[model samples]
Target: MMQAVIDRIVEGKHAVVLIGEDEVEKIVPIELISDNVNEGDWIEIKIDNDGNIISIEQDTQSTKGTKQRVKNKMELLRKRSKRNK
Candidate 1:
């Protein structure tokens, strides 16, 4: 299984994903994806031995936690910037 973020979706065709820390881009067919997937959503993908997508699912819990952390950090930064100004 590999973890990735949905960078973008090419309508009914495919989805562009960003993988790993370096953010390697990969294009996967939309057919292999679970329903309601959207850009910036974190996902877990299973690839078969033949290099095909066996399964893909959104990591809702992880995504929520990460988003909350980012939001908190941004708020802190905003407050600090206001104090400095």
Candidate 2:
């Protein structure tokens, strides 16, 4: 299993995820996911030998931490944007 963060969801198509410390991005089909996931949610993904997603599950601790980090960055960006206005 590998840990990844959901970067975005493409509605009925797929989800883009960021993996590893280098933040390598991968696309996963929406149907492979077991539950609804939002951006910044951390997940554990299992892939088959052919590089197909077999399972995906949310990792609560990682998700919370990632969400907090994203929220903080967004807040900082918002403050910066307001100041530039």
Candidate 3:
């Protein structure tokens, strides 16, 4: 297991991850993992006995009120759309 930075998402199944000073392009089932991961984010990846990256855990900041943020974004979008009409 090592720390890596997500670079470019080539497709739904593959992405280029930068580990240390080397970038390894791996075909992983990232779709099986959580969508919380994004480009430029740091994650801990583990390769199983099959030599496949089986699990990925992102290093994220803990925050409260996620529901409030979504509501606010929706409200802002609604207001913008109304003004455009």
Candidate 4:
């Protein structure tokens, strides 16, 4: 199959999507898909006979977020950890 950029990946909450060309769409409960594959990366996906993502391959260049965003999330995680302690 021609490799398609993950136009979007919506997990949990019914878990279906209508993909558009050359645009952005929000994939919900992104964690589920992320857990199965890697979050924020283009994956080699295979649609099964049932039309589900039955397979995936990692594309390292597809990492999500600007450096600032990653830093902010790490900061938030650190703050939360400190609070838990």
Candidate 5:
């Protein structure tokens, strides 16, 4: 299983996926991604040694955690702004 994030969709045909801490990207056909997934979602991809995708699914926990982290960051930023004001 490979961990990746659905960075964005390209023209509704392919998805730009970011993998690992460095965010190395891979372009995958939209059909290969699970239907429930969307941009900014974390996903698990199973691929064979040949690099053919076997299956893909959304990583709900990772996605939720990421969203929460972003939300927290935004709240902190707003607090700092209010303090400055």
Candidate 6:
């Protein structure tokens, strides 16, 4: 299993996924993933020896943590901008 985030859906057919700590982007056929998933949602994917995706599921806990981190960073940026202005 690998940790990934759904970055975006392209043309309604493929999903752009950012995988693991390195954030390597992989294009996935939308059908292989669960429908409840959306952009920025965290997911766990199971791949075979051939690098084929066999299973994927939404991971709520990771998503929440990631979102909180992003939100905090955005807030920090905003505060710095106010001081610079």
On lDDT, the leading prediction is 6
Task: Report RMSD for candidate 3.
Answer: 7.4
What do the candidate models score in CA lDDT, each in turn?
0.85, 0.83, 0.66, 0.46, 0.90, 0.91
TM-score of each: 0.80, 0.69, 0.53, 0.32, 0.89, 0.82
lDDT of 3 by residue, 1-85 (tens): 7666677677667666776446665555567446877666666777777767767777553112444676799999999999999
Residue-level error in angstroms, candidate 1, position 41: 0.9
Local accuracy of candidate 6 as per-residue lDDT tens digits, 15-84: 9999889998889999988888899999998878887788898899999998999999999999999999
Worst 10-residue lDDT window, candidate 3: 59-68
The list of candidate 4 runs beyond 4 A from truth reads 8-32, 35-40, 61-85
User: Which segments of candidate 6 are over 4 A away from where they belong?
Assistant: none
Write one digit per residue (lDDT tens) for candidate 5, span 1-85. 7788999999999999987678878899998887888999999887788867788888999999999999999999999999998
| lDDT score for residue 40 of model 1 | 80
Specify the poorest-scoring 10-residue window by lDDT in model 6: 45-54
- Pairs in steric clash, model 1: none
Q: How accurate is candidate 5 locally (lDDT)?
A: 0.90
Return the candidate ranking by lDDT, descending: 6, 5, 1, 2, 3, 4
lDDT, candidate 2, 12-47, per-residue tens:
679998877787788988877656678778899877
Residue 52 shift from truth in candidate 6, angstroms: 1.5
* Candidate 2 vs candidate 5, TM-score winner: 5
Q: Supply candidate 1's per-residue lDDT for 84.
A: 100
Task: Tell me the RMSD of model 4 versus the true structure.
Answer: 8.8
lDDT of 4 by residue, 1-85 (tens): 3233444444443222222244323343443344544323454445566655555444445434334577899999999999999
Question: Which stretches of candidate 5 lie above 4 Å from their native place?
Answer: none
